[model samples]
Every structure is written in C-alpha cells, then in structure tokens.
Target: MARLGPLLGALVKIRWRTLLGRGSAEITGEVLMLLAAGLMAERFLQYLPEFPVVWVWVGLAVCWLGMSRGPEGVPGQFPLTRGDRMVVRTVELAVNPLSWILVFVTGRISGWGLCLILLAGVEWPTWRRGKRVSARPSRWPALLRKDLRAAVRLFDTALAGVIVLMFVAYAVREANLAVEAAWIVPVVVALSNSTIALNAFGTDNGTGFDRYLLLPLTGREILWSKTVSLVVLVGGQLGLVALAASWRLGWEMGLVVGVEGLSLLFLLAGWGAWVSVWVPFALKAYRFADGGSVWAGLVAFALCLGPGMAAARGDWWVRLLVLWVAGAGCWVMLGVAGRRLERGRERIRERLP
Candidate 1:
C-alpha cells in the first residue's frame, strides 16, 4: 500500500474534467456490455424447448426490421446520411435475414455472424467518418497502419466476446462432428479473415487508396506490412481455434486442420490485401461520384459472394494452389501497376463530385 501512495496521489492530481469524461465513457462501456450480455443470454435461452431457436431467429429478425425502419426522413440511399440511423439500419440489413436464417436452420451462427457485427460497428463507422474527413494528401502506409490499429482496438472487445462464445458453444454442445469440426476451423478462417485487409484498404474517401503512391514507401512494402499484420492476427486466431478443435479430434486431424486453417488464412489475406488495391477501380464501374457508400459496398459484396462461395467450397488443395498462384500474380501485378501509376499521369476521377 505504501508503494502505491505516490501513484494514487499522481492519479488524483489529474484534471477533474478528464475524470468526468472518463466516467461517462466507463458508463457507456458498461451499458454496452450489459446489452451484449442480455442479448447473448436471450440466445442461450433458445436451448429450452419453450424457446426454440427458430423463435429466437424470428425475434432477431423483428429487431432487425425494427431498426431498419429508421427515422422518418432518413434516406435509405447507398450511403446513409446519419450515423446512428445507419448503424441501426445496416446491422439489420446485413445480419438479420441471413444470420437469423442460418441460426434458425443450423442451430448456430457461423463466424459470419461475428463478421457481420464487425462490419456494422467498425467498417461502417470508418465509412461514416471517412465521408466527412476530406482526403488530405498523406502517405498510405501511415494511414493504413493507423486505420488498422484503430479498427482492431474498436472491435477488440466485441470480437473477443463472440469468439469466446463460439468456443464455449462448440465445447459444450459438441455440435460439430469431429470431421466437420475439423473442417470448420479452416472454413471459418478462410471465410472470415480476408475482410480486415479488404476493409482497411477500401475504407477511404473519394481519392481512394491510390494516394498512397505519393508516399515515400514503396507500394509493395506498404502492402507487405498490411498483409503481415492482417495475416498474423487472423493466423493467430485460426491457430487458437485449431488448438481447441484439436482437443476434440486426434493430433493428426488437429495438425491437418491447423495447416488447412493457415493455408486458407494466408491465401485469403494475401489475395484480399492485394485486391484491395483494385477496389477503387472496381468501384468506379459501379458508382464513381458517390464515395464510400454502403450501397456500393453491397454491390461489391454481391460481386464477391459467388467467387467467395466457390473458393470456400472447392477442394482444399486445389483452391489453395490456385489461390497461391493468384496471390503471387496479384503481388507482382500490383507492384508493377503501383510503380507505373505512381510515376505516370493517370487521371482517376474523384468518387464524390
């Protein structure tokens, strides 16, 4: 206690105004935690016969529909105008029907449910903020790193909770068969890991991510660091899932699952990290002047869904080899393109006029 006296005294000497702000922040945090707990507890109740999973899904659907019908005048356009309204609506649009359907049919929501929540909270906030923050000519690496770190911190608690819940569910219910469970690790990793890099690269203003060309760092290096950070985080999570699933199955299956998970994680992270560069270009075809809109995102999403589903369902080895080749090609092409574009006069129009 004596050793803590100075520290306590120093803390007390801090501004009261800062303390008040922090106190409010703490209260907000507690409220959010309580809300999440209540939601999850409601979900847990679905285990009882009186509370069918189907009914739970119906309730979720209702909540989503309620939220989607926002303030009377709010435009339901590509990019929502209001943050709170957008948050409420987008979460409903993204999660409700599909996730509810999945949970109702399968009795459990896949990692995709977690991904949806993340998209609503983190990716949506970035888009909403980016709309207001004009493109200042800045280095891409610094911006990318800042965004990545901010996003990780933003979604950390929500993600950790969802993963823990998944772990508990898998452990207690033995819901997944040993073989299918082994597959789940790789499938979930492959399915979910790419969005981080993808969203990071895509979530900028009308200037697009191309302004990175003006930076001192080579595009390859910028891409490399982003890919590395994304891969490490996703790979680490995949590894943990493998470790857990391994305890259920034998070591052999465990090792195989782990390798599969890593392969998928790296493959998608690399591909997504690279293709993220083309987002601005691809998006140009859909909507050039309306920058950072969720409607544009929805279209890009639809374009990706077929390919993503194909890749996810294909033979693991074949898909892995194909993705490896595609990723290598993208890496080389993106470098060449970055250098050419960086040095040359490529007049890319702003997405927002």
Candidate 2:
C-alpha cells in the first residue's frame, strides 16, 4: 500500500508510451471529446464564482465519472488491475492544470465536500471485473459473423445501445399511452446508416474488394454477402427498438413495426448495392464519411425510404402486402446490380486503394 503512489506514477509513464504508439487512430475522436469537456468546464468555472460550494461537489462527481469507465481490457482478454487504471484520462488528471484547480477548489470544501474526497479519488478494485464471452462463430453465417465482429470493433453496438435506452425511457414514461409511432424507428435507423450502406466497399479498399472478386462466388453472391450483413447489423437495432415498442404499445404493434422495418432494410440494401458499384470510394482506416457523391446518395435515400415513410400512414394489412412487393422488387434490383458489378469491376478497383 505504501508503494501505491509509485505504482500509479509508473503506470502513467507506461501509458504515455502506449499512447504514442497507437494514438493516431483514436486521437481525432479523443481530441473532440476533450474540447467538449473543456467547454463545459469553462462554463462551470464561470458559475463557480457565485455558488462556489455547490459547484465544487459537482466537479468532484465529474472527476469520479471520468475515472469510472469499464474494465481496462475487453472480455476474454488480459486483465488490468487497480494499479493499471492509468489511461489518457488519468494523464489528463495529472497534467491538466484545470484538474489541480478543481482539487484546490475542493480543498476549500468544508463538510460533505471533504467526505466525497474518499469516494471520488479513491479507485475501487471491484470495478475491474469483465464478462466472459462464449464466442461460438459456427452458430452464425460467415458474412454475418464478420459484419457483427466489425460492428463491435467500430462501437456500433454502443450507439445502438444508446438508442435502445432512449426508446425504453420513452416507453416507460408513456406506460399506459400508446401511439402509432413505430414507423419513426425505421426512419431514424435508415437515415443514420444510409450513407454507410451506400459506401459498403469503401472501407474495404482495393485489397478487400479484390479478395471478393477472387472468391469462387459469383458477383451476385458477393453483393448478397455485403447487403445481407448490413441488414443483420442494422436490423439488430430495429429489433431492440421494436421490443421497446411492444412494452409500451403492444405485441401487435411490435410485429407490425418489425415487419415494416425489415422491408425498409431490404429495399435500402438493394439501393446500396447499386450505389456501391456506381460511386465506390476508398476510405482511410477507422474513419467514416458521406458517400462522396451527394447526387447518388440523395437518389438512394429517395428510392429506399419510401416504404418506411408510407408505413406511417398505411394500415397493418396493407403494409404486409407492401413487404412482399418490396422483397420481390429488391431481388430484381440486386440481380441487375450484380451484373453491373461484374462489368464495372475495373472501375470499382480504380476507386479503391
């Protein structure tokens, strides 16, 4: 226990070296995060002049949250312990003058403020526990499994979890009241991921796209792999939202929304196949951008989102018929896009790495 201070200091130095090695990939997002925190802190300090005691407690809570992230390592990975909690945020705690100012301000805190010091700065050891993963890949299709893994690495699950929480809160607040707002869920999902689906091959670069061409599968099969993966990934988000709808609206409403959302996903995926062939662009690793061709993107959105928009106004039975029609039309679109894909293989390759 006497060596704890030295251990923390050593860990911070080690973390700095690790940051210098792999920070480039994460620096963009992390810097933006710091800027936002700085802005909030500036406003907080301005307010502190009037109600110094109240804001001091708030500052302590903020610091505690900054340190209280999930276990340092992922599930099924190596573990990081109490002494190893050093991260970029920990670096900020030491190096940032604002942190010390908060500390200095906190020292002036007399009664309850002093009690919080033990809770705020002291690292709790139990927080290091992580879930054990039962990773059974054979249960999932190859393409879907790959896409799911990519989604996890990209933190898409975090975004979906946040959206699901929002829906849950809305449902709980309107516990007895029900509305025909299920259609809005699909609309939000589509708009959020429209450009991502359209540029499906962009992240792969030439090497990954070439690997697809080299496979024994036909062009249509390659398109199927890409398109189906997008549906499965995006559909997971829709499924969670629909489950929340069931709790608030009713099971019947949940079924209607799920079916409607699946139809929208199919139509959008078909449109995405065409866009992938027409306006494919290479992307730097670990980044996202608009699909590069605004005209193509707008056209895709217009064609694909109609079913979802119409679902809001139509009857449930009418939507069932529309789903069948959509699935058929999407199949046809995919077939044509696959043919064009083969013809434009060289052109697509030129746009990638």
Off by over 4 Å in 1: 1-147, 153-165, 172-177, 204-214, 281-353
Model 1, 1-353: lDDT tens digits are 35434433433343233334445545475346436545654544444343344344433333333332222332333343365444444444444343444335334443446444533443343345436544566445455555554334323222333443454345445644346545543453333334454544433433544555455667566566566666556666667666766777667555655656555544555445444544432221101111233443454344334334434466556545545654565566557544543443243223221
lDDT of 2 by residue, 1-353 (tens): 34445555654565455446445635565455445434434432442343543444444334433332323433114344544444433543465333454555555554456535533443343343464755566533765666555443332233333444444544655555345446665665665566556777766778878877897877788888877788777787788777877777779777877887788787778777878888887543322242267787677667556666566677867787778777887788788888988989999999998
Clashing pairs in 1: 289-351
RMSD of each: 15.9, 9.4
**After superposition, which runs of candidate 2 have C-alpha atoms over 4 Å from their true positions?**
1-140, 152-161, 176-180, 283-286
| Candidate 2 lDDT score at position 101 | 49
lDDT of prediction 1:
0.45
Best by TM-score: 2
Alpha-carbon lDDT, every model:
0.45, 0.60
Per-residue lDDT of 200 in model 2 = 70
